[model samples]
Target: MSNMEDEYDFSHPERGVAVIINNEAFSTPGQEESDDRAGSSHDAEALDTMFSGLGFEVHRYDNLTSSAMVETLTAIADMEIHSKSDCFACAILSHGGDDVIPDNTPGAVLLERQDYVLGVDSGVVLVASMISIFSDTRCPGLEGKPRLFFFQACRGTNMDPGVGVKVRKTKVNPDVGPPREGDGAEQTDHKDAEEGNVDIEDSNVETNYDSDIDNTDSIPLRPVLSVSPSNINKDILVMYATPPGFYAWRRDTGAWFTQSLRTILTPYNATYWSLTTLLTHVNKRVAVWYESSYPGDTSMNEKKQVPCITHMLTKDVYFRPKNMKHSTLV
Candidate 1:
């Protein structure tokens, strides 16, 4: 293991490779240029700058087809650089949604949902497919190393109409006694505790579902391995721009999630704070600081977005300062 007691090692000369896939234009047969993503280039550029500043070898790919996307990732996973690098990171900015297919069981009617990103040609690429390419058995060079992925796209067609917060001022009676066991107050406390536990477990659940896509072709299922590798998905992290069944907001300037990420994960912060700490800041910023403000569409106004982060890292991950020299491994 290259890591210390609780932290992943970043003492190698090469920090790692960072890949940015930006899909700004849609060339599907019936889709218009209006469907083209207007501000995705800004996201791509910002990620490139931010990752490059972190001592990564950044590779940027623009407007690739679904097949091309897979090929590109396959080539990267086959590279020898991972043996010497400390981690891997990838950011994808594109139109994305859920891939729904009708289950073909006799007298059964059901729709299966799979998450995917759109290629420029309107072809779909499953997010899971991309992650599987870097599994331990497939990309041995990155075994036990952190693999980070960031996705900026709409998860579904649902628009969030933020709930109004009402503040009620009430006077408390001085004669009121403290709540006893089995009272309303005690039940409320227990409920709160249960909710707190649910919140913690929510981070590990895969609840995100992308918005609708126009493609009619059925999405192929990933083949199940008869024997799964123990470390197949050991040290991976995936972050999405929005919660399940919600639209990710993007202005003409840039995407809400990417902007917050670049702002929060600066070199100074990266050196002192864990990656999860920085992402928590990013989540807070995106959820609180942004809201949809379309004047013509009242229903779309005041919408909120919250990013979701899931990780399976066995140790704390940190990005060292770019100028810092490699330290002797413990």
Candidate 2:
């Protein structure tokens, strides 16, 4: 067998592909954009450090639109790993509103088109689901393999009252409006790759549905795969940043939820621990860390968001590689 295929762990193998998406560029995307965009660089850095330590072959993409993300994810899923690889993992860092985020550039695209409500690349979930489908029939051995997705973006609209602790990444941003059609190009041309670069005005954005939607129906955009998480056999372990109708905390240090995942998966793969065990560690760490440090922050304190494990998986999984290198997170 080829070396690449030989590396894929269908049963108990070595190495895994780690896809990390960093939506916020800090200075590039800027702070004034949204509450979640702030400190995203820190989250990305943490993921990079953790995953690198664990010996994962990490691939990264940043500031992508719903369509661009679809292309990237499709390419990843289309890849044919060897019969030996056990699983795959992905980390998404972005400003998510009900499973989707506006295209990061926020230039001329405008809010209407920007509100694609995508989960896969918007924050984390959408990408995970796309990856999971590949393991379904295309990869017979991966039928029951583990697919881990870690999300650092907020899941709700509530804001954290985290105070006193100064985060360095937060900065000033100007309110920008969505660019008019053909603002950057010709007026006759409507939708094209160039139109993808339009400016968006999200400050005046409105919600078309209920505010307290559950994660099960969290995804906003119409996805290509219609299967619910309950039906899939591929084990998908989703570590959400917060509970339904609750906002996940992003500290000056970093996002509380993703940081916890990083801690659990760092230095080496969590091969010894099952999906449940790893999430347990994540749940405890984020809750404790935020409450203790922030102290008296009623909004964020005491918010111990549980890791929502949708049972599509048929087997146990450890996020990182087993014996190849030190444990890490991403």
Candidate 3:
């Protein structure tokens, strides 16, 4: 076998590619502009720098509609680069909503499109369902390769009420309810207007249902390969900025969780830390920062948040600097 097939070395500049889907403004067709993710650009810049420092080629897409995001991922899954690479990574920054689609169908709470009620991006694409696009069969070159996904978005409408303390209280944001679409859809539908546009280019299709949704009333007699997570998500690692049903906190500079991620993955830190250990550190640090907040009367004290990670990695992973030679999974 060639050296490429024998071992995986992330230090090599061509060993992998990382894509960043940075959605700053969520202005879908016929919808008023959604709330601007004030500091997302900084978050994107930090991610680009962090990945580049680790020696991976980076591709960034901005202001994409749902269709564009899907097209981009589909195209990447078909790229020749994976055959020559050790791994792949994708980072998505957007607003998240509940699983209420236009047809009252349940979908992932990620990505918004026009007409708040309708699912776009060729239909409603759930966050959990995004992985199938890079299945071992669909993207053969990526089989057995690490696919890391980082998400910085809200998973639900609930906000952290923050623990009560003896300290003086600050003015809290009045419960304005969740964001919403212009047509008086539920507040949760507002989430559909953010991220990229849903069906700007692929506007012809009205309801692109997520593949996970089963329309049949009868059970299938034959077993499907992608039905189970273990079978299809072999070498994947997903890290969310916040736990399910929570809002991911971001400041003027960037997201506290991702910023902490940058610190833990840095060369100086990774030499001694494993990927599992690094994520633990990120979670703890983020929680502590949120709890601290602004001291004194104006403080939103005891607000707690935790990062969540799901992995199916068979071996341990330790990130190494570009110039350093380190252990690779067997």
Best by lDDT: 1
- Whole-model Cα lDDT per candidate? 0.69, 0.48, 0.57
Q: Write the per-residue lDDT of candidate 2 for residues 255-326, one digit (tens) a residue.
A: 666656665654432443455655666665454333322334444333334444444554454444453332
Candidate 3 ranges beyond 4 A from true positions? 1-13, 27-34, 100-124, 161-232, 291-302, 327-330
Ranked by lDDT, top first: 1, 3, 2
Each prediction's TM-score against the native?
0.74, 0.57, 0.64
Tens digits of lDDT, candidate 1, 116-200: 7888777788788899999899999899889999988766666666544433322111111233353332111212111111121
TM-score of 1: 0.74
Could you tell which candidate, 1 or 3, scores higher by TM-score?
1
In candidate 3, what are the lDDT values of residues 1-330, reduced to their tens digit?
113233334543465889988776644577564355667787788888777866678998875666777788899889998877778888887665334223233774333321110022323345655677887888887888788888877554344654433322222211122233541321112111121112322223222222111010011122222211212288888887765555566655567666667755664444445566677777765654343233343333224577888888765655565556544412
Off by over 4 Å in 2: 1-13, 25-36, 99-135, 138-141, 158-233, 268-271, 292-307, 319-330
Highest-TM-score candidate: 1
